[model samples]
Target: MAREGRQWSDFEIAVSDYLTTLREKAGEPSYRRLAELTGIKFSRLRDIFTKQNGTPTLQEFIDLCLTFGKDPADVIYKIMKDLEAKGISLSNIPAQNDPADEANAALASADNGVDIDAWADRIKAEDSVHEEQP
Candidate 1:
C-alpha cells in the first residue's frame, strides 16, 4: 500500500522512467518534438509524463507510447498498479483482452452471415461525414 501524501507510487516512478527511456531512444527529443510527433501538446505531455497529479487519458498515453514504438501494455500496467497502490477498487474495470478484438469480432460476426465489412465501411463513412461538419 502507498503511504498517504506521497507524490508518486513505485508504479508511477516506473512509468516515468519507462517514458524517459522511450524519449531517449527517440533521439532525446525535447518535449516540443514529442508533442509535434504524437499530437500531444508540450504542456499536456509534460503534465502527463512529468507531473504527478493529473492523470492522462488512456488513449492519449497509448498513442504516445505507440508513436515511440513502445508497447502499450507496459504503460497500462504501470497505471493500473498506481491506481491499485492508491487503494482504488477495480471491481468495475472492463476487460481489455487484446487490440485485435475489434477486428476479430467483425470477422466472427461475418461468419454468422452478417455484413460486418459493410457495417464497418458505413461507420467509416459516417465518421468522415462527422469530420467534415466542423
Candidate 2:
C-alpha cells in the first residue's frame, strides 16, 4: 500500500540518506550497533535506510537525530531545505498549535502498550481514510 505513492517522498529520501551518511560518519560498524545505541530494532533501521517501508515516525526520527548527536529540529530544517532545493515544496504541511499534543498523544498510546511503529501505522491508516474522502 505504501508503494502506491509512486515511491518514497523527497522527505523520506532525504532522511534516509541523512541517516545512512550519519551512520558512516559515526564509524558505526553495522546497523546492529546503531540499534543497540538507539534502542530501536535493527529491522526498523534497515527498513528506513532501504526505504522498504514508508517514512519513520517523528519519534523514530528524533531517536536517530539524537543517536547521531544532531538536533531533531535542525535535521528537520535540513531535510526541508533539501526538499525545497529539489523543487518539492511542502509548505502546506500543517503545524501543531499545541506542542504538548504530540507528547500527550504519545503518552496516551504508551498507556495502551502501543509502540511508536504501531502508532505510526494507525495514524497513517487514519490519514489514508481522510484522503479518500472529499
Candidate 3:
C-alpha cells in the first residue's frame, strides 16, 4: 500500500529514511521480529515502515532506533538541527541549573569539616545521661 501523496516533515523524512536503510542493512527482517525487539505493536511497525503512518509516537521512534542498535539521541539531535534550520522555536530546557555565586559563597562560608563521629558520640552520651536521670 503506497501513500502516493503526503507531506512529511524533515524530521519524519530523515527518520524514515534512516530506518529504511537500517532495515536493508539488516537484510530486511520481518516486521513481527522488529515489533518484538522494539516492544512496539506489529501493526504499528508495519505502518511506520510502509508509510501507512505518517508519524510515529516518541516512544515508537526511540524504540525503533534503539532496537536497530542506533542511538536515538543521535537521531533526535538531527531532528533538533532540522527544526532549527526550519526556524522552529523549541523551548530550551536544560538538564540542570548552574550553581549561583551566592550559593557557592554560602557553602564556602559554612563549616564543612565538623567531626560527625564526635558529635554523634556526644549526643549518645547525653542521651545515656538523660535516661539515667529518669
lDDT of 1 by residue, 37-127 (tens): 8888888777666745555566776777898887899766766766678886556666457869978887787687858779799999999
Q: Model 3, range 54-100, lDDT digits (tens) per residue?
A: 57778888888888888898877766777777776545633233579
Full candidate order by lDDT, most accurate first: 2, 3, 1
**Model 2: which residue pairs collide?**
none
The sequence of per-residue lDDT tens digits that candidate 2 reaches over residues 1-134 is 33432367667788889988898898855778888988889888888888876577788889999989999999988878777778886767654357798888778777766487887899999999999999
Each prediction's RMSD over C-alphas, in Å, is 13.0, 18.2, 8.5
Using TM-score as the measure, name the better of candidate 1 and candidate 2.
Answer: 2
User: What are the lDDT scores of the predictions, listed in order?
Assistant: 0.73, 0.81, 0.76
TM-score of each: 0.47, 0.61, 0.52
Pairs in steric clash, model 1: none
User: Highest TM-score: which candidate?
Assistant: 2
Ranking by TM-score: 2, 3, 1
Candidate that scores best on lDDT: 2
Compared with the true structure, the alpha-carbon lDDT of candidate 3 equals 0.76
1 against 3, candidate with superior TM-score: 3
